[model samples]
Target: MAVGQVGGLLPHVAVPSTMPAFLIPEWGLSYGEAGLMASAYAIGYMLAAPVLTTLTDRIDARRILIFGSLLNALGTVGFGLLAEGMVSAMLLWGLTGLGFAGAYMPGLKALTDRLAPGDSSRSVTVYTGAFSFGVGLSFLACQLIADAFGWRWAFILTGLPPLIMTFVAWSLTPVTPAPRAGPLLDLAPALRNRTALGYSFAYGCHCFELYGVRTWLVAFWGFVAASGGAPLGAVVVSALFTALAMPASILGNELALKLGRHRAITLVMLLSAAVALAIGFTAGLSPWLTLMLMLVYAFTVPGDSGALTSGMAAAADPRFRGASMAVHSTVGFAFTAAGGWVIGVALDMAGGVSQPGAWALAYSVMAMGAALGPVFLWWSRRSGASS
Candidate 1:
């Protein structure tokens, strides 16, 4: 479970951390164009998630996981080798995104199915923690590699870990028969569940904020490093905050298990929103202060992500685990693409003005999304529906 999750999430974190800046000069992309490139991946992810999950129901998850991991690795390496222009980059990114969709949710279902049929929350926590840890580790590892070698090597390095993990999962995961279900019937009812819809909305908002931040954090820090004349490494500084986020994410799940998922998610959302508002108002005060606020926001924003997923899993019909997860991934990542594009638009509109202020405004919009997320979750709970 850990290996699969880490493999799945490594690309999630590494791409956002490195790609925005890495492809900039190489592809001669503007901020909007870079954002679109990121969106290209999300678009592919959204499109493939459901189809792959349906496939998982017919194929053994272990086999699906291994194949997915190989695809993910192949896609990443292919992107590194073949992406030479804007169009080509988008095409490759979409393929990489398709690979990601195959790996992430299917991998989770594999872990969940393997659970020992007791209170699965603890196992869920561990799996989710691996995801958060992988994201943070990806940022840290990729940043170091990018600094030492180059962005191409960073992709190579990120791709290798998953390829290795693929074999590990194949060797370790117990074999099981493919689940039986009518694919359309299994998926249709999930779409109508109000709580599920609400959870999906909150997740979308969370992704809107989370992806916006992840996609831009290094660039934001780069701007800070240049303007402040700070001696810190931009990527390193970004990695520290991202790494701080991992524990906070684990803690959020723990808190949610104690407090009701809705309440815990609401609290985290509010806190993250406040931090975003603070950054918007005070970003130019001092570099350390600005980074500090961002760190605080980062820690809180993603903390509840696992809780949200776990809640969705619990709320879902046991028979439709794969479909439910597919829905979850599709909704979350679709909104993520929107969030990236929106931030890019905000940045473009800000033009040559204070770049930090522009970024602050963009980030503030993300915070608003975070704030609004809880309302949907709360509504779901009040409606007496399971997410």
Candidate 2:
């Protein structure tokens, strides 16, 4: 399932990974417009996740997974064959995000539903790690394909992988979810689960910072390369950034286990904020320094992801797991959309992407989001959230 999930994610970042060099020039888009293109996906996910993920409470998640995988394939391939400019690109990419909204958390719910209770937390964490690994592969594969066969083929080829996940869904043994007691869209139960809400809100903050950096990372590295810093191509740096997050997420979950989830997540978010701020201010130095700091930022940034996910899963009510996941994902991706767009706005307002100060302001935006995560956790606890 993990491998198949990775396959589904191959096209996940195809646009963002290649957008700076390809779409911006081809469409004559400003940084803000490009960011809007990226945010479109998140907005699509945000709009669809609550409904799609919550449906798992009554139906087999496998059904949703199969449908989602096919939609992802369609959206991705459609982008390759049909996209012409900003509007079309955003629409197709948003379709892809909607598809993913069905696949990701539903797939996780499918897996956890079959697992023994004792194994749920670790398995959830590992699956989330696989999510990062898949995203890293997306960066690498999309960039290489685009470089070799133009950006269109990048979308075309990467689109094929999601089809693999449909077969995985078909092979899964069908299991009914726990019976639900309320309306399908009623998020009140999830909202009332303060323990899960804490982790979900923290996940939102994490996604805000993570997606903001990810949406602009290739362009930022392009800046670094142009400024005579790291000469590494966007492909290598972007791929490495996400790939490093895989182990970082896994290890972070382990740290959370040992140190307590709240303390560990707090420390990691603080560290991530510090590193992001450092990157903003000092990344234009030597090539090696820039590369090193970026790698570190990558590690620090996603370090809380698995912990946050596993914590939420562990805390959620079994009967309302689908609704809980919907809340978690909706909040996370809502912030994700805002993060991607806000950073670009920051760049435009701070004197365009060429200015170092613009990049600094962008990083500061990410840093501010990360720094607020612990506060959310604190608030959740104060509100009587307990696992």
Best by the lDDT measure: 2
Model 1 local distance difference test score: 0.76
Clashing pairs in model 1?
A: none
Per-model RMSD to reference:
2.2, 1.1
Superposition TM-score, candidate 1 onto the true structure: 0.92
The clash tally of candidate 2 reads 0
Q: In model 2, which regions exceed 4 Å deviation?
A: 229-231
Candidate that scores best on TM-score = 2
lDDT of 2 by residue, 203-290 (tens): 9999999999999988888888887746687888899899888899999999999999999999999999999898898756666787
Q: Candidate 1 on 216-236: residue-level lDDT in tens?
A: 777777766666755566666
